[model samples]
Target: MSSETETFSISGPSHLTAIDWKNTYHRRCVVASLVQGVYILERDRQQNRIGSQKALAPLWWNFFHFQLNNMLVDSADHSIFGAIFELKPCLNAPRFVIAFRGTLIESGTRSRDIHLDLKCIVNRLHKSSRFQLAIHSIQETIGLAGASNVWLAGHSLGSAIALLAGKNMTKMGYPLETYLFNSPFVSAPLERIKDQKVKHGIHIASSVVKAGLTVALKCQHKQSKPQQDDPFVVLSYWIPHLFVNPADHISSGYIDYFAHREKMEKIGAGKIEKLATKHTVESLLSGAILDRISEPLHLLPSAELTINKSDSTNFRKAHGIEQWWDPTIHCPSLVYQYRY
Candidate 1:
């Protein structure tokens, strides 16, 4: 057997051999493979090697009995950012999956992706053309297959795109099942602080400042309280599944963000926590400057946060999409549900 085949042979569970959709691990492994397929697809295209076995779209999708239905191309850089896979007949799986590839720093799409990453950091990703295209593709998919039959999955920057798109669709009354792997959380690296008391103190201070700012903004603008139908409030019920490694600074902030909210509630500061959790410093600043409220891409109200407890000390390995599918890793998770 060729080395390439050997390398990918044990990548993960095969859908042809086992159909266990009820298994959370099995579902994670399959969805993660589909996301990896998008990465390989883009890599193969960039290298001018489309049909190589390194392209796991065919090998993995064929094993899962899914066929590529469409390629989501980025109009700015002409890079393939995502794909639509439809299950073949006689398969027991999601009818359709819209999977996205994350940033490939070493590839041709590096510049375009890095630009989008910057946009994400500033809470301006929603205005980007790539994200607009993603939203349109998802809308078209739902129109054709209905939202219940479709699943959304992405990694890193791709996960941010998926997240924004999912939020948009959910507001329009189409809640999707989303899987976000190592999604970037733009914030200070509080998770890196080893001293628990110091980290907690900083978190409390940050939350107080944010909550105070929100109250001041409301008083200045004479704006009424948010209604029950407000998009952010409505979004609290549509929880996405988030996978992160504690060692990955880019994504680990989510752990701190959600945990701090719980701590605030425990101390009878739920009101401050509520306002603070709904807005980020970047989003608040952008909103004040532009005279329009902007939602931060990473400020999720609810999520099934899965933290991988793998012993790998490498940043690249910790933030990698492949780790989600690694059967040997330990992933303990908690559901963070927001209450009004």
Candidate 2:
């Protein structure tokens, strides 16, 4: 019993077993799936309203105000979906889960904000005006709850929004964690276009230039108004857990690749060294197989539900949120087997 609870300052891959990392990965995956489910629900309702020519009301506000007051208030500026929960005493801490809805189907009433999507890739400040307003709404709700911590989660485009929002929120002195599922590469990844020779060359050159600029910016950041606990540094350490499926081309099948790289960097920080070398090792042993290979040796045919059966016309299903939480299919066995 003493050995199990022993404390030491030693750090390395040796200190952490494969099972520990597996459990952590699976746990985060489950949370990501739940977040994706929330986004799916929000998206579905929005689409339904669009089809019927009626705007979808922000239903989360009802729950938000219900816990605080009996009177119902309608506010239309809140574009993002979010919920507030009243937990048991042990979990009495003020908590929030802000879920962002994915891309609009036709951009019928949202054309002006479309440019923000592309702009966000280059400038984090270029978030959609809707998201900007949503942040204000979130802040108001947090004030009402006296929230000490926030969890930002989203799927697809929402994931991108969540990342930007989380970054900004942390800068504003909020303790937050972001869980992103099948998040598309807001900034292009070098590996994403490796197969395209022309594009790969262009990406490589761009990467070189970007690296130089990044180094310069870091140097400038260090010299100008250096605070002991810089928010950007805090944000860097609070790495967003990103979950991706190999078939999820919206994420370019490389989001997991980048995430794996960052994960290794995080584990190997300071005196700690990463144990797993290959992404497959982490994915297979950790039971977080977000990536699916086209061909697997001795591969038993997984249930059809695991794979999207939709035609090309239904690209949305290809990046479907449903697949993330489908216990009968994509979900890892460990998730459903235990309480998590």
| Best prediction by lDDT | 1
lDDT of each: 0.84, 0.41
| Model 2 residue 66 lDDT score | 16
lDDT of 1 by residue, 175-250 (tens): 9999999999999888889999999999889888888877777777676755676666889899999999999988
**lDDT score, candidate 2, position 30:** 36
Lowest summed-lDDT stretch of 10 residues in model 1? 1-10
Show model 1 residue runs off by greater than 4 Å.
Answer: 1-7, 10-16, 52-56, 89-92
Score every model by TM-score: 0.94, 0.52
Q: Over the stretch 1-340, how does candidate 2's per-residue lDDT look in tens digits?
A: 1111111111111222222213544334334433433443344444564332242222222222212121111133223344332322224222455666555444432443355455544343333465665567557656765545455666766666676666566557664656666566533344445465665345334434434443444464453534435333444334555555545566643433333334434544311112121112212322323332111111111111112222423456457554443333433221100000
